[model samples]
Target: MNKLPPEALEHVANYFRTLSEPTRLRVLNVLGTSELSVGEIAQLVDSSVANVSRHLAQMAQHGLVARESRGNSVYYRVADPTVNELCDLVCGSVARRFDQVVSAHAAFVASTAPARRRRAG
Candidate 1:
């Protein structure tokens, strides 16, 4: 099999590293829907303003998101629509896995539940 060039591998690794944090993933998820200010993002993600700002800055540095300053607030958006696509891919996979688990659990519960007799009204 052909291996990725070292530089390409490094770039891919860096991108994955940026998304390795749950907070960063949450930030990306929020930004995927609409642009939001740091304060709004922090509140939505249950993170501190300082921490959100730091994460946004790191994401911007990696070209994962773009920021625009309006008045005193900085609003961030996904740098590329492809990033949103990647987010969707990850989220879809997770949702499918969760659905499978829930279905399996439901089947097990149904089998284990006591049968009930029908009563005439």
Candidate 2:
């Protein structure tokens, strides 16, 4: 892949920074493909309405989410579909890493088991 310009790299960094917050990630997961009001998102994430609203505002500003008003309430949905793909990629990588660690630990324990038995006897 070609190297990105400094300004482009900065924008990329900013976008990642926007998704860095755990609450925002939870908000995105709860949102999925559904457009939900602040209260709905708050309920799903088990957070206060005010807190959810603030996070939504920040996400909206970053173009990570879009807002629409329907009668009395504003509903939000993911504006960048690629964000889901990005999250999935990271999650898969993490899961694979965890599996490797577990497998390695099991192998280590198995390898040492016979040595321990030999020493005991």
Candidate 3:
């Protein structure tokens, strides 16, 4: 198997590190839809503005997102459209897996439980 060069490996590692947090993922999800101000994203994600701003800053530094200032508001959006696609793909897969797990658990429970007779009038 081929291995990544040191610089490429470092870049990939940093990218994964940046995406390792829940808040960062949430921010990316929200930004994937459309551009929004920091306050708006914070509200949607139920995070403090300061915390959201910090996450945004980190993402912007990593080139995962881009920000533009309009008067007093700063709007942020996904830097690359592929990012939204990637997030959607991963999240959809997770949702499908969770659904399968729940279905299997329910089936197991139903099969193990004894059938109860209906009460006579």
Best by lDDT: 2
Summarize candidate 3's per-residue lDDT along 35-91 as a digit string, tens digits. 999999999999999999999999999899999999999999999788778777888
TM-scores, in order shown?
0.77, 0.90, 0.82
Q: What is the Cα-based lDDT of residue 87 in candidate 3?
A: 74
Model 3 scores worst on lDDT over the 10 consecutive residues at 112-121
Model 1 has an lDDT value of 0.89
> What is candidate 2's lDDT per residue for 1-121, written digit by digit as tens?
1699988888888888989999999999999988899999999999999999999998898899999999999999999999999999999999999999999999999999999999999
Superposing every Cα of model 3 onto the true structure, what RMSD results? 3.4
Model 1, total clashes: 0
Residue range 32-110, candidate 1, lDDT tens digits: 7599999999999999999999999988999999999999889999897888788789889999999999999999878
Give Cα-based local distance difference scores for all models. Answer: 0.89, 0.94, 0.89
Residue 44, model 1, lDDT: 94
Question: Taking the candidates one at a time, how many backbone clashes does each contain?
Answer: 0, 0, 0
